[model samples]
Target chain A: MSAAGRTVRPVSIASFAQSQNVRKDNERNEAEGLQPVIAEVFANVGITKDDVDFICSGSTDYLIGGPFSFVMALDAVGVWPPRAESHVEMDGAWALYEAWVLFQEGEIDAALVYAFGRSSLGDLNEILTLQLDPYYEAPLWPDIVSLNALQARAMIDAGKATEADFAAIASRSRRDALSNPKAQVRHDVAPDVLLEDDYVVAPLRRHALPPITDGAAAIVLAAGDKALQWSERPVWITGFDHRMETHSLGARDLTVSPSTAKAAEVAGVADGNVDIAEIHAPFAHQELIIAEALGLDDSVAVNPSGGPLAANPLMSAGLIRIGEAASRIRAGQADRAVAHATSGPCLQQNLVCVLEGA
Target chain B: MAERCAVIGVGQTHHKAKREDVSIAGLVREAAKMALADADLTWSDIDAVVIGKAPDMFEGNMMPEIYLAPALGAVGKPMFRVHTAGSVGGSTAIVAAHLISSGIHKRVLTVAYEKQSDSDAMWALSVPQPFAAPLLAGAGGYFAPHIRAYMRRSGAPDHIGRMVAVKDRKNAMRNPYAHLHLADIDMKMVEESMMLWDPLRYLEACPSSDGAAAMVLAAEDAVSGHYPPAWVHGMAMRSEPTMFAGRDQINPQAGRDCSADVYAQAGVTDPRAQFDCAEVYVPFSWYEPMWLENLGFCGQGDGWKLTEAGATAFDGDIPWNASGGVLSSNPIGASGMLRFLEVAMQVRGQAGEHQVDGAKLALGQAYGGGSQFFSMWVVGSAKP
Candidate 1:
């Protein structure tokens, strides 16, 4: 009846898989695009649909241009007599959070979490404009890039960062993304050369913008004995939490992310020394903002898997960060890692996951 | 293994085709405020908030939860958004309950709403996606064929569907909040109604309603003064692919698995004899029987027989949808939670005019997305 001394249901990411990121994936529907990724994750975990106790997914119908798009994606899983499942409209990271909650109850042993988005299917910038207040800001049609530009300008004006710093982040991301097959944006241009390029939005350059992509990612979570039996090395989630800020851009303090700072604290991000971090900051300047909010130092390797700047696939981008961080633990690359995901414009909501090798 | 959760408060808006008088924030707040009042609490008592809706396209506002946070009194608190298609309402409630059962939060407020009047649901649903077969009509078009499949499999009489339509409408007369209250509803009238989809007459289908449903869930200690809390005996959600080779759209496996899991937890070996009443999401009339089998109220291929014998009627041994259900009132996103809230209302003896007589135990169910996604819960008067 009480949480004190309650059995901590340790759940681990058993297997993870993601699709190849591309500028435009016109050949396959969301289900077809996700089928191979789901199969690969299951194959890696050596399990079938029958072995899974629950299924949860993260997606937004806005990305695919329809309502109930998640319904059609069910064709990929081929549910017959139905299976225990749930979903989050935010991102795959939150879907994994839901599955973790169920696992904590000790009722379900294993769950599959997957998410897909076709950011290139529509005018993503224009579509994202709708995320603003419909009555106030949306009428102005402030696209994501323009909004980020405002933030970037504020950071510059506040003397917290410089345009060169934003360019450097983009340069390093592209250089790092060269190693990621799933990354859609990869170029070896130097930061100085990037600064020479014309600005897409005053202080922000085109290279700083994430490539619109079509992609899918899936992860399998197993709890307690299932986690121990699934693999030799397991990536255990130590702490997970998410928080949201007010929606109106005018109502927020555009310079700082209090939500991310609070979420990181609640998730015990400072309780242990983090070796690696994967932060979801689609815009280059926001990376600087979140890295400081998370209190990550230069010693902590950030976005070794290239992060969202490499392939920002809307809803799936955040989940991919968690998967990327867990993959490092499974590969014996790090003892502890932190993965973060953001939703809504100007990072209105943030989720933090701290993973440790077990 | 987990802390027990209870539904301390339930609230919903009076469903209608259009609620143009209020803004989106006002629509959701109406339900949230009611739920808060029911729990004898204020906005400050809530620890977290979870909201769900079908799609942002329905309101032409992407992730409206961001804008709705203040209206839901979620400022400076954790807020989460869930979209599991039509079953989002049920899933949203489940997530809130989990917060309590996890012992992380004592009080969680969950809300689901859809203002369909903002846009055409049919067009929103039919938006063409790259590299996909275009759906000619809306969801009804996609589901009609499956209903036909159920008809063919069960060998059910054509009139059976009409009977369910008439029965639910008559029941709606008792539900003051139901969207479609046909005072003169009858079998003949339903049978003669225009066919929106084959086997789904206009009267048999759920209306495109603008409304919202909200619930306040609390942990055991948090419900000290809340009397007659509808204890959450069991909760489960299941899903499968929309389609695959030999996948049965009629009587989806996810719905069956979800029901089995919930009933097992609730200690109900036989839902028919154990449950005094049920509030199930049956957007179309024929689904009443289809879901009867899926939810284990009857054996496979025998669900229609329960309808034929009037066993699912309000006065029957196992009453189903005594408040007219989704067929009579459906705010797509909130329809699932409406079923859940209705079940809670029954156990709490708070269902006013539409109260099922002495309903001690009840089942609530909802399914979405090609019938692949399903969420169900069992509620009872006694604390678990």
Candidate 2:
């Protein structure tokens, strides 16, 4: 604990909504794509924009090839009377953290958090390359898959895992996706079949990669009394924290996630037994790494909503993990869960949010 | 209620058109180190970091905070990045305050910066959208027409903008850190400058500068009297749909709402009488008068009177931008935080040459994205 977390106010997820994950969505623009999901999320909770004291979003200009993409996405909510709103360049999970911070301030009763990514709009691989170290790494244009492969290779060299371990994780994640209605890539595949898949980079295989998804998601959060009033079964967020590592790939121990472990500890993820966890690992091998960082035993079910392997929507995928974990608690499927979000190359930055059912 | 938060220290890099002397990481570290030094703290003492900037395209790096974390000594520490257009700088500070005020962190470090020389801001902002109207002109071009409308509606004289240009440039002469210190600057020079966007002469507009602004925020209990802290009385942000009918771009409702929200929390019933000074974003000279009206410093359509009457100068009653505001130095992303940092400087009695004498209260505001986004804060010398 940072000493300041002692007096943290309790917050809860009142509602969650998402657009169907898809490989292409040429039919709608970013705002248009987000409109229905925003309305549905608010409607699902029986609350409107007026109920939200603040609004925060996560998105990137690279997705749309322009700056201030969230500016346009606000139209979906009809931000009238100039509501309090902000946007993050990272993931919606971060935006949720901002909202959570404000909610803890005890001024605002509730907040709206949303994120949208049109990965299909441009070259996802090329756009992501821009996130690299411009001077030393981006010039090389090592795509994200290759970077993940390097991490996987490091993991393999450390005798921590193998290519088969990555395949088994992917096979299980996709098999679980069969029940998720919004999943973009859902199918029953044997681990043996996945092991035969061709390598996209070196140690990374096609089955280990997440589908390129264009999707949007939203989460409505309420604080204190508002939480009790908004939803019949609000999933209380008991602990939340995010930690970042160094930027240089060579500077860090690629096989270990000290950042995720620190975030999980700060978030109090291990205070009680985790019933389930929705981890945001865009790549399968990374999931094993983060799960270890969280110190979750096999007894704790992971990614009940298929996780990012089912429908990885860049900016929204991380937020969806929180929603997925919360939804399980809301539905009485689980009592305690930890939702994780990762960013940067090889999951250098991570967020862990511990949720509980009352 | 939220815990009281205060600005214990503030620091800013010298604004310049191109800071080739330092890399982007070095540029921000300069401000961060200075802020830490001012606060008598170290990297290990800070609990977290919250950074904000405009578009990543400005530096051609996506979410540069990932790389900046090491420079800020944020590894193994909670870190957040805020990007809300130009208002990001102000909002970044607000988010940091929340970390303290919400009892999440006792000490938080926040920063905003822009290395415009790394990439052409004009081209970065003007990137074409597939389904929307092309932004033919950069920010100035988009805002020039709004400036024209304010002139037509307020019936303000053309010289109002020129006078503002002269006054701000003159103020820059006193600010050693200001990018444009035109010692010989005058209305004639402003008038003779090329009209980049009609009604917005080159001299009347903000220069593209590279700079960073950083601040150390602490919970009131942590302020052990090591340094004067600017108590954050209130902080707020508001954003509206970027494009819509009946949107008053001249005096945006977001700006009005943002100021009203912050002022109300800070108990500022009358802005002109309540605050000792302000640091407002005025990229183009014309925005000075427009924001004066929007911020409730004066009645609608009467803002030009303030600028025209020399009421907004360093020697004026409610002196604004005494450290030479965005009009003199604009590191696009850091411009908003400079407004915030300058206000803190004023209230802390540290704004060297341009300090508002015996300043008790101060206000800072920033707006961005076609005037649809707004962030503002009120600071005071005394503990709130």
Candidate 3:
């Protein structure tokens, strides 16, 4: 509340679309994989690229194994004479955040934000190890799954969660995934049966881990009169913020995600009654952690779209949550929803987006 | 109208081939700390942090700002990361400045860094992609043909590129933070250097280095704590696809449009006469002249003549790269910001050994990707 009287403009998600999540998309290049999705989003919104004032994208070169991967992906949008474009090498959710901030500038009326990832080229776990401290943690070569397992184990040892609780989350997620056509993993299973699955890492079973996914997602954001003209019901972003934690796992408390808590607080998660919460927790146990950190009640419908456990497309998954939550609002299924996106190991960084029906 | 913004402080590390003494976080912190100290503030004084870098693969880290946020003292605060290839550094600074100009934050810390020593950038640039030609060679190989096209179109002599190399490397000797201090570097040394890409010699190319650049930007009301604020006169960013049917990769329209927009905002009818100095991205020596024309400092096809006339020399009418520029040290992500920071340093009179005398108005420019992305800004000693 630096400026109490500042008017908070309503930023809405006008339309959203995404590509099918697949393990390997060898047939389609990066731009080709993203073109149809962008086309679908624009068609749904009844607008073209020319209508948008700003264009932002989220992507990573590590996934493509090259530099300027996002720059090449711009070909899908066909920027001929150049445009006001910017890129973030993070999840698409953060790109939306940047777009949201640009909207606050009041100069730009609308923005198009998108993200893409191809996890099929290399070993996802092995590649994520590079995100650690190069001189210290990376030299040890601990993969992402093993690191998450450490956090899960610490939570279990501290009596914050249990193996049965992890199975229950996986069961509910798979059950919810059955209704999602875009979900990669969608099969209803009993929690008791899921408890029989072998452990990928101690205290974390195979069911708790997210599948390797490749996909792309796009969202169009419009403000003021443009938002009203684009949709009958606009999913307005009321509060949005993101925070980060230390890179060293040992330096942070493994049992709790301070970054997520801080982001949720800053995003005004406690201000209103949220009917649905979409948390980008790739691991089953991490969902419980995020749920607790956000202070959500049991009455709040969590992950109705199956969340990341079903279709975790690295860079695009976070943005997909915001899209999904906004879809619920647009459909009049919920008055308010909270979408969360996390980056780095064990949620070293987190972004929270609070959307409401208008 | 937007709120007024100014560069309150700037900091940069000594660029080198290998900064093995510090980790990536430590390297960025060195510059961030110096910027904070120069601004006469602490980490808590800043409201947010924006980081930019060329590619995560350059440091073997994907979305490094996640891990780097806390080290830069951005925990519990809003943080954003920007990546637009080589122009990322400049774009990062612009993004930070915009936060203030948009009246969102009073004080913002913008940082950009690249640890090329951690991973081989050549390998990162050569990753094979389906449907694309096997351009297995590094960045130099990709741009060499473009340089040849510039030479053919402009009809510039071959000696022009060598002269730029000698001039920038010599300027590097004056800046202690410059990575390559070739005290005896000359035309003879450049001519004998290895030819990595045809028409581009090794000495003509920028050296891979590990370094970081940081700047503390503040709104007009927040500038009272600092002296000699480099007022931001104008800023512009433009980007087009890397490849298209008839796009000019040699002299990108994006760069020209970006410069034109910035110049218009800064009220510069003539860049050559109005601006006291300039800092343009020149990873390859020949780019200095090419950018001189693209930035509207001179007419198109007449840029190389400026180099030949010695107008771009350190002691010339419009001195370019007085702080050695990217030709001497390129941390990829930080190189573009270094250009912007050097421009601010000149205007603030903070550039100790490399300070240009009586520099009032200055221009900073950065272009990246296949030269399709461009970001530029105009700053002056007086508030606009």
Candidate 4:
């Protein structure tokens, strides 16, 4: 195969840790909130900072309303002698992808990946508006919820899904959250009752929206000998890839996720049996769109850990999906699984990672 | 093992104080188009695109990569964004190069840019944070004391900084794309310039400009451009804390370790003798001497001696910043990448008027955030 299309070397997720998801973490700052999570990830594998050859993080300065927020967050790692490090403004899932790419180079045996965000810091609805095209969409100050609603409405008009389906997804995800200790929203309410809730936007009820969360997550990636030493049942990342669609909403088919489909195909998510999937869909209708794009069957258990619906930490949500899927495999819940992450409005970009146990 | 990678194309915009004619997307696409044209490739040929910038607050846009995807022809392709403060530009290129080096993609395009004219950088840098003392004086005030510290430690004469200001500006006149072209730049003019931060003159500092830089990196088998490829010999990045007890701000261990790692990878026992030239991030005139010692170009405290002897001039044996560097055109986020691509230009003999004669190997370096974040690379004419 050509270098561009050839598969990448497999890397194992040795350990994962995250802070308790909350609406407002007023007590701890970014570094303070991340300190315990970073320590827990390292401690879980009985290793120190020196064990990892490289470190990478995913975060945004916009969350803190200051520049270089990642700079101060480095204090949590206590890099006294300095370390080989890099940061991405996307999300923790991309950070993991970056470290995974470096592992393929055969230069490093282990790496640490992390991400943190506090959605409670500012007006998230207004702040997210700035992510639109400054020359066109941003001038109108379109809220994120309205954009997602447009997609939901598009799905309804196409006869692909209904408001009831959105309610059903929200009901199942929140019910699953009852078992997840770190999840912020957990309930056993029925879909019919959820349908009666007031709409934050037309066709989208309050339950369909993700809860505001302040949280941090960390994952340690191990290759070769380190994988065997750290994990009893190593969950290897067999394939990983991400794709982006055009930013213009009018140019895309909002009822479907072509980016997700393309990324899933490239990551070989359907090459084998998928026992479970952890999908990062902030809105209820998105879960259905992404699941259909992934080509998953009814046999596949989706969002067993409640997914973004239960705890959608801005930059950390996508990474949490990968960690949750890897954890299920390590726990012997499934032999193979698919994890998905998304960025941009209406899932304009998507990432897919296929994991399997040895 | 990693696959060999090379820079097949490089391009930049005509830097200016304000590119009012172009939007953010227009500025970045201008550079990207030039890079693709130089490589003899189209947008479809690029498998992925990676972009980097200083901060979202600089332009009041959160993660502009999402908006820029369509403009850069990233739709239906993998798009990545990197942010590591001022060093983000260099690290951004390193990440794009790795896509090829790791054999994941045969060809990759990387871009770094800054439109500081969109907003006030000083205001963005001085925003007060809870529980931390605000940087009320902006960047210059924060670094001026460091310059004073270096002056005290090195015992270098004050005139040494004026000499560096004179040399870089004179070199800028030869580069058409440079933001500052002071035709009559000299020691007298530099001395007469008004002082901003104590011990640092206004003319001794970098000019705020709007620009972008881009490059197309390809695997060894994929290199088929019009110009010679600048082979990737070594690349590295190191970062330390912003503050700590007993930290040597003058000669940071992070900078030393970063250079040491790259030099080791390239098998350079003596950087001053091995590399033909370097494009180091000297945002202030005094930084030329300070970074000279920090980058191991000279022994401790002896960096000023090289400047005083005219060894760092355009005609000097080891010319620095032949492309004018940050001292002439600083677009914050794009400044670091200018160093990286300028070195690539040197090795490829595509530097045009500022081309260092017979340049075969060169170094590119950038640092950010209180001189803690460091990224460096060594490129050569021959493949590793």
Q: What is the C-alpha lDDT of each candidate?
A: 0.87, 0.91, 0.89, 0.93
| CA deviation > 4 Å runs, candidate 2 | A1-5, B224-226
Per-residue alpha-carbon lDDT of model 4 for B251-351, expressed as tens digits? 89999999999999898888888889999999999999998899898999999999899877878888999999899999899999999999999999999
In candidate 1, stretches whose alpha carbon ends up further than 4 angstroms from where it belongs are A1-8, B152-155, B224-227, B299-302
Off by over 4 Å in 4: A1-7
Model 3, runs deviating above 4 Å: A1-6, B224-226
Pairs in clash, predicted candidate 2: none
lDDT of 1 by residue, B1-384 (tens): 389899988888988999988888889999998888899999999989999988889889988887888889887677888988888888889888998898778899999998999888888878776566877688889889998999999999898888899889888999998999899998888878898889788998889999999999999898832448999999888777764776678877667778888988899999999999999989989999999998888888898999989999989999899999999988899999999999999999999888988998999998887777788899999977
How do the predictions measure up, each by TM-score?
Answer: 0.95, 0.98, 0.97, 0.99
Ranking by lDDT: 4, 2, 3, 1
lDDT of 1 by residue, A238-265 (tens): 7887888888887787778988998888
> What DockQ, between 0 and 1, does each candidate earn?
0.60, 0.84, 0.65, 0.85
Indicate which candidate wins on TM-score: 4
Deviation (Å) of B70 in candidate 3: 3.3
B63 Cα displacement, candidate 3 (Å): 2.9
| lDDT at position A79, candidate 2 | 90
Summarize candidate 3's per-residue lDDT along B322-378 as a digit string, tens digits. 888898999999999999999999999888888889999999999888888999999
Highest-scoring model, lDDT:
4
Any idea what lDDT model 2 has?
0.91
Clashing pairs in 4: none
Query: Which of the two candidates, 3 or 4, achieves a greater DockQ against the reference?
Result: 4
RMSD of each: 2.4, 1.3, 1.8, 1.1
Clashes of each: 18, 0, 0, 0
TM-score, prediction 2: 0.98
What range of 10 consecutive residues in model 3 chain B has the weakest lDDT sum?
B219-228
